[model samples]
Each structure stands twice: as C-alpha cells, then as structure tokens.
Target: MTTDSSDLSQVDEEAKLDLTQQIRDAILGGEFAPHQRLIEADISARFDATRAAVRTALLNLTGEGLVERLPNRGARVRAISVDEAVEIVEVRIGLESLCARKAAVNITDADIEELRGVRAQIEAAVASGHLVEYARLNQEMDRRIRDIGGHETATRLLERLRAQSARHQFRLAFHPGRASQSAPEHIAIIDAVLARDPDAAEAATRAHLEGIVDVLRHLD
Candidate 1:
C-alpha cells in the first residue's frame, strides 16, 4: 500500500499547523513561560509529531513574535521588554484611534448593538473569572471594531499589532481589578462610535489604551 506523495504532503502541512497552534496556545496560556526554551525534539516527542513539523511550528511562532530564535540557541518563548511593550501600546493607540474614527463614520446602529452585546459577554466572562473567555472576547471586540471601520489596510496593520500585543494584553486582563475597570473604557469607545463622533471616538480609544499602558507600567 503506497501512500500518495501529495497526500503525505497535506498530512505534513496539517501536522505543522497543529503543532504550531499547540505551542502558541501553551505560550499564551503561560504553560510555557517567557524566555523558556522550546526544545524541538522534546516538543516533537510531546506532540507525537515529526521534528520537521515542530521546527516549522516554531518558525511560524517566531514570525508572530511569540517565540524567538537565537543563532546558537534553540527557540524560546519571546520575552518582551518594557520598552517593546510601550512601543506596542503606542502603535496600537495610533491604529485603534484611527479605527474608532473610521468606525464612527462607517458603523451602523446594528453594528453598535452587536458591539454592545460582545462587551456584555466580555463583562460576563470577567465577572465569572473566566480569564480565557475574556481574552477571546476581547479579541473579538477588537476585530468587530476594526471591521466596522471599513479600512482594509488599517485593519490588516492593526491585526499584526494586536498579535504582538496578545500575550501582554492577556496577562494585563488578569491584573487585580483590571477587568472591572476596563468595562467603562470599552463602553466609552462604543458610545463614541455610536454617537458618530469621530473625535470623541479617537479620544476614547486613546484614553483606553493609555490606561492599559499605565496599569501595565505599575504591574511591571
């Protein structure tokens, strides 16, 4: 029984993706600490995947900035510095404020209602101490905001920036009293967009991100 070459190639691709997501989840879930080495052999063994798949997965994660590859050293979970975090927040502020301004012009009443619903779910997640759910909802909220803005280029840029910020943002969400405090900020951004106030929307988005950065500074 000979396996087709194309079928084997597809299987390899699927294996790589599966391993990639597994490692990415581990890093995001704090199962793999920042700067912790990810030995390819061990990961391949653990996931019961080939070393080639594990290497491809690590490389994909490196592109996402969730993992780093050193010349002599193997891959490890990326450790973002305070300065890098600040830069990420700054970029997000610029992009998100623009997203809000555009959304103010583009969003419909129905979109606003949907955003409110998502925010409500986020609040519920927080109240229930479902940190993972909250993180997922938070990302959904951001995507909705970006889509509402109707800017393809900006949305793509914001997506990359958000990917860079994902781990820090997730950790920040778990900070003491953070989830409760964040609701009003999210609401403010939604309200500004709903009111069709671009200036207010931009200001609200900036303030919300600035607040997160400020809190992160103390937490750091």
Candidate 2:
C-alpha cells in the first residue's frame, strides 16, 4: 500500500502545528524570557525537531506577536513594553466588555453555576494570598466569559493579546494589594453576568479592565 501525497501533507501540517504550540507555550509559560535569542540549533535540540521546522515555528509565532525576527539576528521572544501593555489592555477593555455583555444575554444556568464556582475559588485564592493561583483563576474567568459569549473573533484576538502581554500580567499578579483589588472587580463582572444584565455586565467589565490600564500606566 502506498501512502497518498495528501496524507503526507496532512501529517507534515500537524507536526508543524504541534511544534508551533510547544514553542508558543514555552514562551508564554516563562520558560523563554522576553527578548531571549531563540537559536534554531538549540531549539531543534530542545524540542527534538529539525532546524527547518523550528525556523518555521518561529516565523509562525512572529506573526502571532509572541516572537520577533530581527534582521540577520534570527528570532527571539518579543518583549512588550509598558506602553504596549497598556495599549493591549485598553483594547481588551472593549473586547472583554463586549464578551461580558453577550454572555449576560446568552449564558445558561449551567454556565452561571460554573462561573460561580470559579468565583468562589478566586475568592479563596485571593484571601489566602495565593498569587499564582489567583492569576490562573483570573484567566479561567476570562476564558469562561469568552466561551459563554461565543465570540470567535474576540476570542482569537484576545488569545494573541494575552500571550503578548503575559509577562506584564504575571508581574501585575504579584504587585502589592493588586490581587485584593482585582478580586472584587472580577466578582462584580460575574455578578452582573449572573444577573443577566447586559448593560451592567459591560460596564463592570469595562471598569475592571480600565483599572488594569491605570495600574499598567504606573507599573515599573
């Protein structure tokens, strides 16, 4: 039996996608620091991929705003400046508020219950000073709202922006009293959505992220 050409092409595409995701996750997870050089040979060895494959993956990530390709310098993780992070959050305020408004209109009972559970966990994490856990729960809440809203375009844009700004956000998590302040804002968003009030949900989401923009403006 001969393997079809299309089958080979499909396999290659899947492999490329898998490699891309692995590298993207490493960058977002802080395994690769901002602006650190991504030598093709080193990445190939680390991920057991060919240099050509690693190069392709890096180029793909560059388009996603998670990596940068310097002229004659190969590739490295993209470093987002404080101003860029503030801009990203400002954009998110609009997208996330839209999601919250739609979620309020579209959420089912099950979604409400699931979000309430996440809210409780967020409160517990904040009360216990578990910064990392709180950060994770915060992401979970955003993800849940996006899913509930079913806005594919906003979800895609938010994912890229989130990855690009991950470093700034991670740092924000550990800022003094930031979690305490953030928890209440997230809870307000959840409450508004749970109440099925689209206008209130949008306002709460906007207020929550506008506060983030203010904090980012002052971030060292």
Candidate 3:
C-alpha cells in the first residue's frame, strides 16, 4: 500500500504547526527568556523534533513576533522594550475598549455568570497575595470578554500582540502592589459589562489598559 503524497504533506504540515506552538508556548510561558538564543540542535533534542523542523518553527515564531532571527546568529526570543511595550498596550487599549463595548451589548446571562466567577477568582487571588494566579485570571477575563464580543479580527490581532508583549506583562504582573491596583480596575470592567453599560464598559477597559501604559513607562 502506497501512501499518498498529499497525505504525507498534510502530516508534515501538522507536525510543523505542533512544533511551532510548543516553542511559542515555552517562550510565552517564560520557559525561554527574552533575547535568549534558541539553538537549533538543542531545541531539536529538547522538543524531540528534527533540526529542520526546529528551524522552521523558529521562523514561524519570528513572523509571529515572538522570535527574532539575526544575521549569522540564528534566532532568539524577541525582547520587547519598555517603549515598544507601551506602544503595544496603547494599541490594545483601543481594541480592548471596543471589545468591552461590544461585549456589554452582546453579553448573555451565561456569559455574565462566567465572567463573575472569573472576577471572584481574581479577587480571591489578590486577597490571598497570589499575584501569579491573579495575573493568569486577568488574562482569562480578557479572553472571555473578547469571546463575548465576538470580534474575530480584533481577537486575532490582540492574540498576536499579547504574545509579543507577554514578557513585559509578566514583569508587570509581579511588580510591587500591581495586583492590588489592577484588581479593582479589572473588577470595574467586569461590573460595567455585567451591567450592560456599553459606555461605561468602554471607559473602564480604556482606563485599565491606559494604566498599564503608565506603569510600562515607569518600569525600570
């Protein structure tokens, strides 16, 4: 029995995509530090993929702005500077505020309950000094708002921007007193959406992200 060439091609593409996502997750999860070199052989061995596959995966991540390729230096996780992080958050402020408005108009009873649960968890995490958990739940809340808003284009753009800005965000998450400051902002967003107040939701979302830009500007 002969395997079809098209079938083999599809399998290869799937494997490459899987490998790319694994490396992307590692970078986003902080397993790979910003600007750290990604050696092809080491990555190949670590991920149990071929050098060629690792190379392709790195290229894909580079396109996604999660990795960078240098002349004669291979690739490394891209480092987003404070200025760039602020710019990214500025862009997010517009997009996320739009999402908040749309989500306020589009949210249902079930979505409201779901977001309330996440908000409660975030409050609990903050009250207990679990900053990491609070950070993660904050992301969860953003994702839920996007889903509820149902803006595919905005969601796609935000996903890429979020990945590119992950390291800076991770730093902000652990900054002194950041969680305490941000928890109320996040809760305000949720409250506005649950209240179905589109104007207030948009205002709350903009305030939340604008605060991040302020902090990014002041980051040492």
Candidate 4:
C-alpha cells in the first residue's frame, strides 16, 4: 500500500487509525509473536513507510498497551498474562454493565432493530461455518450496545480493554465450540437491551462476559 495512495493516505482521518490498526492486526494475527521486538527500520520495511510513520503507529499501539516500549529499546508486542486477562474482563464488566444500563435508557427503536439484524448476521455466519464472521459480529454486537448506550467514557474504557484482551480472546475463540456459543450469548444480551430492561441487560452482559472469563481461566 503506497503511503500517498488514497487507500492508505496519511492525510485522511482514517489514515492514522489504519496505521495503528495495521500494526495491531499484525500482532493479533500472530505475524509477530509475543514480546517480539519491532524495530522501526524493520517495520518500516514491512509496511513500506517512513521511520516516522512507523514510530507514530508504534506509539499509538503502546498507548493501547498492545506494545511495550523499553527505556533504550524501541517497541515490542506485549506478552499475554492470565492475571492481566482476568483483570481485563473484570474491568470490562464494569464498563459494559454501565453501557447496558444506559442503552436501556437511551436506545432508539431503530438501534434495537439494527442490533437484531446484527444478531441475525451472526447466526448466518455460524450456519455458514465462518468463525471470522462470528468474531466480527460478536465485536459489532458489543460495539452497538455501547454506541446505543451513548456512554463515551465507558465505551472508551471497554474498547481499550477489548483491544488488550484480543490477543488472549483469539486463542479462546479458536478453541473448538467456543465461538459458536458466543453468538447465542450475544443475542441474549441484545434481547435484554431491546426489552429496555436495564436490570436484565446488565445481568445478561455480566453473564456473557463471565462466561468468557470462564474460558480464559480454563486456558490458565
């Protein structure tokens, strides 16, 4: 991808996000292993970008806790940890529970409809045996919940945690039968939200995440 090409232009609003996302994709896709040092010269070569551009991308990921910067060293992909994974879910529960509560108060009819549509997409992905689609829709469901909730701070908090958890979650999702169960849990959470029941929505969201934590714990 050419740096100045419209598809990868750094001047556009999406350019910066794409750069960070590219780096993230590489790490989470296992193109770079845990604690793998990412030299600016090397990443610049890989991404076909200037050292400065690669630096900016590395800094962004470092801020998200996906990359670590040593005092004299550049950056490296962060290693996963069971303790960190558990804490991440605990933090997500707090933020997502708030989103579920706010979604009950603030979601519109159309938003609820869209959520149902998202659930349907997930079902289709499952039936088609596409785990990738299942994961994408799973993220979308959580995203729409936060969007409908309109809780910016809470959404940002959960989003960061989700990003951090992705490295571990991918492992769990790839495990046999886990991703299949995720869609149903997603639907139940949305069902509670669509019913406009804050209590039920909160409960369902909590249950959904706790279920995920169970699997992550099993990994440990």
Q: What TM value does model 4 have?
A: 0.88
lDDT of 3 by residue, 113-151 (tens): 999999899999999998888888988999999999999
Clash pairs, candidate 1, are none
The best candidate by TM-score is 2
Ten-residue stretch with the least lDDT total in model 2: 50-59
RMSD to true structure for each model, in Å? 3.1, 1.3, 1.6, 4.2
Residue 71 lDDT in candidate 3 = 97
Task: Show the lowest summed lDDT stretch of 10 residues, model 1.
Answer: 158-167
Q: Model 1: what TM-score? A: 0.82
Tens digits of per-residue lDDT for model 1 on 59-164? Answer: 9989888889988999898887766887889888988999999999998879978987986887688779887787788788778889999888888777666666
**Clash total of candidate 1:** 0
lDDT, candidate 3, residue 116?
91
* Model 2 TM-score on a 0 to 1 scale: 0.95
Q: Per-residue lDDT of 35-84 in model 4, one digit per residue for the tens?
A: 89999998888887778778888888989999999989878999869788
